[model samples]
Target: MTTHPAETVHDALREEPCEDAWWMPGPDGFAACALSSSARTVAEARRFTRATLEGWRLCSSVAEDAALVVSELVSNALRYGAGGGGKEPAAVCPAWLALTRQDGTVLCAVSDAGTTAPVVKVPDHLAESGRGLHIVDQLSDAWGWTPPDRSGKTVWATVSSVRV
Candidate 1:
């Protein structure tokens, strides 16, 4: 974990074996943690999102929504944001989950080592999978994916809970 002032959240992760998990309270209202592109990271990411939001004194609704978004984003990253053309090994494919607060909103983003974009699929009750992005769409006020950089792409969602 690193809290370097100028470094972006993606810099906090490296494509190496995730021997241990770590978290960082980054500069300017940002916090991030390192994760591996594995199924287990979904639970871990949701937990981290809740903890970070609590630490930031955010509302429960925002925390809940953010946690769900974090789970979907991390799951997508692990499932789709992996493999092919220099993508790191699955066991150690580095991923990062980040949160940043701006007034009444919290931004949840997951960055991974794959360049593919996230697509929202039509809901099919019969299918066991392919509903992650739809959940993200329903929960987040706004969500989208960033184009791939040298390392990979980032999918982000925002949840706003401004009380009167």
Candidate 2:
């Protein structure tokens, strides 16, 4: 894929999955996966996320942050995405995650078929819900989402290896 220098942030995030199909063109490395929207698939995605970060020799801090991002993204996909006949409506939605190391940052992107953008809610102290995107925003250098060309959208984040 030809990466345009002036591409929008949405384009950049969408392109990462396709660009990272095998590996990225960088010194670090890349990992990509097309996951089924199922409970078992979520577990698999977690493993894949860990392996991908470790394979790239990312710092522990980056890896940990990436893991959390992966978990939240995958969980959101399984919950809101179309797959798994587990109490949810049946729709064919493919979920994916891609990781790439660029310059001094590690970029992670997760794509799913839900067009509704994710929101970071202010959860009450006693409530045991929400806070996924909130944590991602606080931990990563940057985080955002993109609507794909056809359907679905991708949520992405970047974190620096070194503490800022």
Best by lDDT: 1
Q: Please list the residue runs of candidate 1 whose C-alpha ends up more than 4 Å from where it truly belongs after superposition.
A: 1-19, 26-28, 89-93
lDDT of 2 by residue, 1-164 (tens): 22434543223334233321222222247666656645556555555666666666777778777788777877776566534333232243357778788755878888776756777788777877687777788888888989543466788988878756
- TM-score per candidate, chains pooled: 0.80, 0.71
The sequence of per-residue lDDT tens digits that candidate 1 reaches over residues 1-164 is 33345653333343333434556765466898878654557777787788778778888999998999898888888777755245444346467788999977998988887777777788899999989888888888889989886678889988989632
Which candidate ranks first by TM-score, i.e. highest? 1
- Candidate lDDT values, in order: 0.75, 0.64
- The superposed Cα distance between candidate 2 and the true structure at residue 110, in angstroms, equals 0.8
TM-score of 1: 0.80
